[model samples]
Target: MPQNIYLEDYTLVQPHSNFVIAGGRVFIKKWTSLSFNCTIVTGNHKPTVGLNQRIIERLHINDIEKDVVIGEDCWVGANVTILSGTMLGRGSVVGACSLLNKSSPPYAVLVGTPAKIVGVKFSLEQILKHESNLYPEHERMSRDELEVLFEKYYKGLKSMGTDYLSPEEKMKSMQYANMQYKI
Candidate 1:
């Protein structure tokens, strides 16, 4: 993997999954959950004209490479496939057996074969109202507090640069991973 890639701790990428981060840059924000049989592809082989030539034999076979970014507080269900050039916004939820090949809005809930936005987990007003609970009200991080934490984390992910992972992104990622949520 390149130095630009960042994988926050406590990210539950289950077994039998492939995160092809070596081919290109991939920035997975904190507290993201990827279930079993998920595949994140950042590169794809281009079409060749010759019929007889094998993939290995063809020299200079063009390859399209693009960055795959997963925002914070996102949950990718089992058998999900995230293709190259896909940018998932923060606090997004992807249903199981979905194929995500395009960008999504923040707090969107996507499901289906091509992964269309079905609904939002939380309305914009609801999210903003719970923002204050992000800080530790009493150290336990009640349910309301957790929601605030997720929103804060999402903001950090939203601001990640094309270069290195920002401090806010890292802090949000690692912080939520240590919370009460199980992988």
Candidate 2:
């Protein structure tokens, strides 16, 4: 309902969804789903040294805002808490009762507190198929990158930001949605 909140066609938020959209934007792309009792926070509380809690609260001066993004076709499970500045990459599967605090790679299957990467939602071939329908040919991940991502996942390594989307795409998505995500 706010100007800073952008939901593209086919975005879904189920019952009991709570969003704290403060100084920044919250962008959800097409086909993303948020399950029940999900909480998305787009801002933080400022710690002021001298200000009283009631005064700060009454003045609304204790807010620090940041963007939040849920990428296309992501599945966020029930009772999840997505914190400020987190980006759920395209087709990510977030496990129920998880706490997500950081950005994740595309197609990742995330679970547990702070949402560690446990698996990938699809194989490389399947990912290719999935992205083909959701993204343009130029935007899809190359076979080499897919292989690299799989290797990193297997080795418990981190994914390079460019493995899923480009910087230009990230900027565009941010500009379009006034929200989050990056390459």
Q: Give the TM-score of each candidate.
A: 0.66, 0.78
What does candidate 1's lDDT look like per residue over 1-183, in tens digits? Answer: 446467875456788888765357778876688889999888776766764346623442566778999987689999999999999986689999999999986677788989987766664445453333332334222455445645654433332112245899867767765453444
Off by over 4 Å in 1: 1-5, 51-53, 56-60, 135-183
Model 2 — which ten-residue stretch has the worst lDDT? Answer: 154-163
Q: What are the candidates' C-alpha RMSDs?
A: 11.1, 9.6
lDDT of 2 by residue, 1-183 (tens): 767889987788999998887578889987789999999988877768999777775566877778999998889999999999899988888999999999988788899997999877877777776566557678778889888878877355333223366888866766754222222
lDDT of each: 0.70, 0.81
Q: lDDT score, residue 143, model 2? A: 86
Pairs of residues clashing in candidate 1? 30-173
Best by TM-score: 2
